[model samples]
Target: MEVEDQIRRIMEGEGLEFTELDVHPDQAKPATLRKTVSYIVCAVILNDQEEVLMVQEAKQECFGQWYLPAGRMEEGEAIEAAMQREVKEEAGFDCQPITLLLIQEQGPQWIRFIFLAKVTGGSLKIPGEGDQESLQATWWDRVSPLQLRGRDILDLIDSGLKYHQETWHPRTLPVAIPCSHVVQRLVLIFSNAEEELWVLLVKAPRLHLPTAGAVKTHTLMWASSLVVQDALGSLYYDQEVTALGVLGLQHHYHPTPGRLQSRCSDGVCFNMLAQLVPDPVQRDRDGEKLEVVPPSQPPPPENPRYTWKRIQSQATAEELFPTVAPTSHQDGQRADIGAATVAPQLPPRPRRLRELGSPEAGPGAPAAGHTDPTAGSSVALRPRTRP
Candidate 1:
């Protein structure tokens, strides 16, 4: 009679399709189950100005749909290799994927991996080149809600951008939430070289799905605090921390999750963690702060390496750590030296996700670790170094 019972019976009757099934006890009874063998591939392509390249769908299931260049992983093919091939085939460009962007769900039935890809060679191809769908492909100025086909697509793009940006700048481990359907968390570290890490936290919009959202009615502040506490316990680092600030929260309500994805009529919102940077002033050339360090300046020590994995969204009350609160609060306090600021409440934005991958002299074209079928001898790719 209960959802869990119904799910269990359905699974037993249908014989599981995914590798596993997870059922959690919450007020609403949240469960996540899937066949273990399934995998997905996605590409986040950027142009000359660092803008992204996306594809419009021509498939009947999602006709007139817009999504990052992507497709499903084939049997026996590696995820990374498949990604490289998919992008080249779909976008008509040869790219070397640098990092794991975001592992997210497309809808109730699909899960995907968004990768940051650097254009190594070739130009963007016109749509009618050996593809079945009569779709069009184009590049966008930024990876934001406007670029996405649906509300859910917005989160995927945002998280992918952030992952690409902070891969090498000392980021926190991906937060694992046991939410029923979605696992939402931040993935970067802001280092001021202090005794403690002062990171940002954003609230999870009610409309978005997290395993935690379905079962409990919790506040943003509480969720923010829990993330820090969980980070302190999960990560391997040294330093004490203090909560410096809580920025205002904004909610974008249009384009509900249930609405099927499409190219038009999708809305999105952001809850941001505002950091207080002290070095707001730059030495002036003559007397004014010269416009230097374009926001596009790739993070220092480029081509950082990262290891990523998907975590369950639902966590136990003990795992949430509501009781383990911050020691004290200060308006603007100095953090500990080499302190790692853990931003775990929201997903990292995608264009930002571009820069984080195995250090250059590295790495995707798929089937795990396949060489690019179309990679030319003149275009050199970095070799992978073993640890």
Candidate 2:
């Protein structure tokens, strides 16, 4: 219930939903760094004059071109450590991450953590005194002509600017807790036309948020939809599952230079809010659009293992059910409907995969056991170490 309360307060106050992790302390997958998954970290740094920081590429492919100070995360290293290391190596500055500015996912296999960081020390890299990391680093005035390695960073720079001027999203960073794989602790929500909202919870796990492990082939967000499909079965096709954004993240890696290890130790877990909406294109046997029945509540999930818990707190419900103008994919036009959305139909159902939680195998957090914090945490128990 502590996890539930934590989620409730955040939703009721900030419109950000916190989810209980589906990841247990210990799991079956080795999830070792570099071997199973790889991550890229990007830094968005700005000066008092609002010039963006840029680094010249030294790597063979994009040599001489400019890009953000970014690089691959090394084995068993924390997210912040990786970010700072990249900045120091590529940009020649010591920095601290203020908050997670953005997260770009290519699925379970590839992920990028973007941050807005402020410099703490070190001078900018110059052409003569640099290693293979880069030729030089400088703050770009935006108006200056610069050859860019990729234009994809243009949006990342803009996101940093928007965040610097005024706070839009909540301030979020990776917590210290260790996880074994790329997993999601999801706040899955369903609502009616009347705006009443219900959250999906796992029944056997003592009524906690549904957690899903990432599949290598699919995007990280697809894990949430996979949860819906498993819970709803045949009804999945008519539903749309989309992950809104991350609320909390966990990453931990201890640096031991000469240590020989049996497995890679890097792990990160993302806590996110995902939505399940009805399919807009519902048709009857006569080819006429059908009015989705009982616009008052969500349909029951077919699997008894999952249940929809109605949010009694109106404040929390409102946060969970934020209003966004629905759009049509058919003609790319505005959806002509109220908040009460239609229900689902899947063109193709993804195969059911096992949940990430399993008996604790090696070291670190143990397997799923109890909710009691007194017993233990990081292994066998849910996270009570909320910072």
Candidate 3:
């Protein structure tokens, strides 16, 4: 399959990926429900009147207070499915996720998926209809005189309104590939000075992109560099790994309800773009020869279990690699801002995905509306302000 097309499919919930934690399984703490990790899904739904969809707390600690519809994800439940279930159970309305608006995390162990959703059908659950899930559901104007479960959701509501006003990133939803643990599905790439693109793939089980498990000691994004550091050995520090942005996510509830979920994994797989970036500081430090110096490529890994496959399709290459075009100055001189000295392709073009900067997003999280970077596993998630 074409490389870019495969990614598109994954984003649309039509594709699947195999976990590669076996490559260095010891490096991660795989998801095992209440054991290694726990996932929380929160929904932020807004109505035409600019009011927010909210439910009164049913839990004794905060009874009759207002909050967004959210709940603990079941051991064997899809992320979106869990969100929908919570919305219905709490709000008494059917809803669908528009996109994953934010990711908040206390590391991957305690993560929350926040989404901007739309009410599809159903009436609000009135007072008597309240059950253990909620006392009642209602749409509240931010200015209304309502007591809240917590003030924290104020930021979340604002975040939702901001996204409703302007969409800062692509429409991202969960990919439905079954996984037994939490992993980062890497579109890990290395490029030559000529912009010949290649992706890293795990050779075992099947020839697929590498999926690194999350190590609780560090944030999930660290998984990419960890694998690189392990596989590349001495070459690890010569180049930097740039987390471009999250392309999509994969999650599904695959275990039987009421069954102990400890045996199976209910973690998410973040499909992301991470590139091995070579440092340019020493590009001319080696010598003062006036001759134009060509850049060096990261050497192939000595590990036989890993392989780099070149991208032969030009269209696929462009989707993965950012591009720069010449723009004319007021003086009529055209200059290319990208570092590449050549006509096209290579690293450090302008980025469209902003860093979410969530600790869950880990390292180079984009500030745009996104997760897989942190709204994010960092999704710590002081509600993210839209850039």
Candidate 4:
């Protein structure tokens, strides 16, 4: 009758192993959860001159000491709204959060969200009406030392600066297609011979990668495993499959025609490479024989949803699987492992694909200006002004 019970029944009916990973969040007992936590939002505002914004607290204990524009979240307020409100009240600037710089949590009792924001409007030192908590709002060069309200702010400042310098990952948002969050996996299934690589292509009105949604209850590996199982049935039940690395990060935006489009208007899909070993029971199957198997509930003939396509050449494989490299023996000697002479190296952790047409593309690309909008450069630091 309960959600978890229903999930268990479905998994048993579908011949799926009922592991902890198959449990969805909604199916969990809310009464057993930990107590609700409080949140503190902080904003790291930087001007064109690379000056950091700071406010002198009016409180007696740490009065006149400088701190970032930060405050505790008010009830019923969103995290972004809290950050913006703090920045306006403490720094006198109406800023827009560019990206989440850092998240610090001491269990669930105290959590802090730090954001890197850019000034959009309002003047410096001119606090919004009724803002009286800070004695003064000013910008600091950071190189010059000032009386800091708390030492923890130093780490936050460093994180903000590093995030501004080099972004290790892209910002992601919840899916806008009638779901708070959606987990979809794109798999790159390869042949056992290593001579060819195969990917599941879905032709649902348009040709695209085969993807499975509604996997928030499972790990990325487990979710991808479901996709493989749904498409290939029990053919790979005895085979060992490992997620190699991420191939790309596809942020699907809504088709709505507008300049102010959100990054995750439609949903986000994580394209990952999965290495599959030949099932001992079907070791003799050739690459052609192991073509993609469609889901049991197949799409219409005109909108075929799953088909396997062999990668034509090694060059194409190299392009698609950039992190994957075939291992070679030294001095041109061949190293034999069973029947296979070469082995593919284990890929490093997956990295998100850089967005197309970015300044990071090439040397001739123009530097991204502040006015250009969108998430800006990860490594380029703004010019500093000597205090």
TM-scores for the candidates: 0.36, 0.77, 0.70, 0.42
Positional deviation of 177 in candidate 1, in angstroms? 24
Candidate 1 off by > 4 Å: 1-37, 105-110, 142-148, 163-387
Residue pairs with clashing backbones, model 4? 165-378, 165-379
lDDT of each: 0.34, 0.64, 0.65, 0.46
For residue 40, give model 1's deviation from the true position in Å.
1.9
Question: TM-score ranking from best to worst?
Answer: 2, 3, 4, 1
Worst 10 residues of 1 by lDDT: 377-386
Q: Which candidate is the best by lDDT?
A: 3
Q: Over the stretch 1-387, how does candidate 3's per-residue lDDT look in tens digits?
A: 544566546534454655457446876665777678877788999999989998998888788788889888776678898899999999999998998866655446667778899999999999899899899988898887999876656656776786688665556777655666778777777777777888877676667777778766556666778777766777675666766556677775665566555434576777767777654444445655344334455557767777777878775666666332212122112221122232244444433332233332211122334333232333211111123
lDDT of 1 by residue, 26-90 (tens): 32222222322223567776665656777766667566556677776654344567688777776
Q: Which of the numbered candidates is closest to the native, going by highest TM-score?
A: 2
Off by over 4 Å in 2: 9-28, 255-265, 285-288, 325-387
User: How many clashes (backbone N, Cα, C below 3 Å) per candidate?
Assistant: 55, 13, 31, 2
Where is the poorest 10-residue window by lDDT in model 3?
328-337
Model 1 lDDT at residue 194: 25
- Residues 186-235, model 2: lDDT tens digits: 78888776667888888865777777776555556566777788788888
Predicted structure 2: lDDT: 0.64
Question: Candidate 4 has what TM-score?
Answer: 0.42
Which ten contiguous residues of candidate 4 have the minimum total lDDT? 378-387
